[model samples]
Target: MPAERVCAVIPAAGRGTRLGLGIPKIMVEIADGVTVWHVLHERLRPLVEHIHVVMSPEGEGPFRALAAGRIESGAVSVSVQGRPTGMGGAIFGAAPHWDAHGTILVVWGDQAGLSPVTAGRVVEAHEKGLTIPLVPMPDPYVEYELDDDGTLLRVRQSREGDECRPGGLSDVGVFCLSTEGLHEAWTRYLDEAAPGARTGEVNFLPFLPYLSRERGWPLTVVPVTDPDEARGVNTADDLAFARRAHQRWAR
Candidate 1:
């Protein structure tokens, strides 16, 4: 069977207050002439049909300027996420720019060093339902729970006050989902779901298990051998770590 058609949505609305950068962290120069935005855009360009970068109103100008070539070439599009409603809002906010009938690949803007090889593997493995790449992190900010038979039961998120143990399976900030499935699930979430206990906003993580257990959607877990691929450039330390990881990966 041929690989399903896919488009990408990048949620970049965060202001990166933790990095202490005046601008969004996605625009920060991770390396000479290369920004965090550049890394993700370049990595995802060849894998999908097009890229939709969802940014805050404040970030539109800079991001558009950075994505000029790809935008001109019709390989990328930009949309605004009016508020910081979290990841779920960001992905759905860009909904109009993408093909609703095709698969959607959502990647967090701060996530860097994603391996093209592993990305390709996840794309190829996404025959149907939801496909996600899982990485083993020493301290998991968000952990996925799977049953003995490798079935995804639920997800525990530390940001939402869930107790997370050490050495857990975490996502690499990449996901492939069927558009129809996402639409239906998101509709249900909006109507019936409550705001996260800690975040006080709609979250995307919990919906994963909701789709699997409650809605009977198939969840495929692809293992990522390298943990560096899950690095999120949120803080100054994270930015430095990403820079170092980029150098090591470059060699």
Candidate 2:
């Protein structure tokens, strides 16, 4: 596939209640008087030919206004997620606007620390196949179980007792997937997911284990040396940390 066909899908539909911010989390100013979404778009613009932003209906106007230049240039497109369906639904909604034959770089909208370098690395690693960026966790929290060759086995959400793997890596919600892999994963999710999965949120994490175990899909794991670079702004503390990190990154 042509590199110019590569598209970016940003899932920004969540209402960040944890952050307690009245506005959309991506719209929150992080540094340099620019919103997190602006920084993300800037980082991704040069790497991909097009960007598709998926946001809640209420945030459409502000988001459009903020991204007016890109929209007018036809490099960026927006879609309103009418209902609260989770990340899976958000990406699925944007699928129609993207070229199904091309690859997609999926990034969380609130990942304020994401840098163009890291995003470019993901795109390069994706040339090998499906890729997911993983960051080392200080504590053994939710993490991905990997094979000896760095293939993802499963996503273990808790490592309380017997499940604990000290110094394991966690998923940072950055994924590089071909359109075929994405469609297959979504299809399997709809066919196999039990009722009320992840509280009725059609998440993409679970599909990793299913595809890896059942279909023998090889999942390449790319280590993100700086964990902070993969952090998403979800809580007040997280937002502060992101702001500081962005400042340091900018310098």
Candidate 3:
């Protein structure tokens, strides 16, 4: 088989109401005039030939203005999500732009402390299969259950009164998906998703178990060495914390 082409997909369409920021959370500046989106793109650029950014319709103009050079140079392409369809929709919106025979690296646009090396590690470890970057979590926000040999068994959501496991791995929103399996899973999700669901969105997590159990897709988990690299900016406090983490990682 020919070398597998890899593309990076960034979902930045969320309104981020909790942050109460006037702008999209991904546009929030983390460093001197450098926003989270810039950091994510800079990190993924070295690992993939093309980067597709999914932004809200209203955020397109600002994002384009911010990434003008990259867009003009064909290094980055932006797609507008007509409405909020959650992360799953954002990924699907950019689906047509992906290479049919290649693999995709789905990284959240608000991810901070992401370095080129870290992004490269995920791609290198994929080995032309499915891979999800995981980080040790003090509390199990969202946990991935794995087999003894490291094969992904299923994903478990945190419940009230649950204690954190000693070495729990949380999904860091970084996924390396094979084009074939992605299409299969995405199609199944759209077909089965109910209208006006609880969150009014299709979360990608719930499908992992279905894919592994029903579809028989081999899933691999790659642990992220620096937990900071998997950190995402949500609330004001999260932004502050991520900024500090980025500064430390940059040094």
Which candidate has the highest lDDT of all? 1
Please name the candidate that would achieve the greatest TM-score relative to the true structure. 1
In Å, residue 185's CA in model 1 sits off its true spot by 1.7
Pitting candidate 1 against candidate 3, the one with the higher lDDT is 1
Judged by whole-model lDDT over C-alpha atoms, candidate 3 comes out at 0.76
State the lDDT of candidate 3 residue by residue for 1-251, as single tens digits: 22238888889988878788878887998878978887887777777878889989889999899999999999888999998867777887778888564888888877876667767778888765578878887766677777776566666654322344756888677888888767767788678854333455567776776676667777776767666665678778889998887787669
Q: What TM-scores do the predictions have?
A: 0.95, 0.90, 0.88
Worst 10 residues of 3 by lDDT: 155-164
Full-model lDDT, candidate 2? 0.78
**Model 1 lDDT per residue over 100-169, tens place:** 5478888888887787888788888887888999988899888999888666887889989998778899
Give lDDT: candidate 3, residue 52.
88
Model 1's alpha-carbon lDDT is 0.84
lDDT of 2 by residue, 1-251 (tens): 35686899998988888888777888999876789888888888888888999989898898899889999999899999999877878888788877554788889888888867788888877763578888887764567887787656677654222264677887676888777666766776788775343365555666677666776666776778877765789888988898887777778
Whole-model Cα lDDT per candidate?
0.84, 0.78, 0.76
Q: Between candidates 2 and 3, which one is better according to lDDT?
A: 2
Q: Give the TM-score of candidate 2.
A: 0.90
RMSD of each: 1.5, 2.6, 2.8
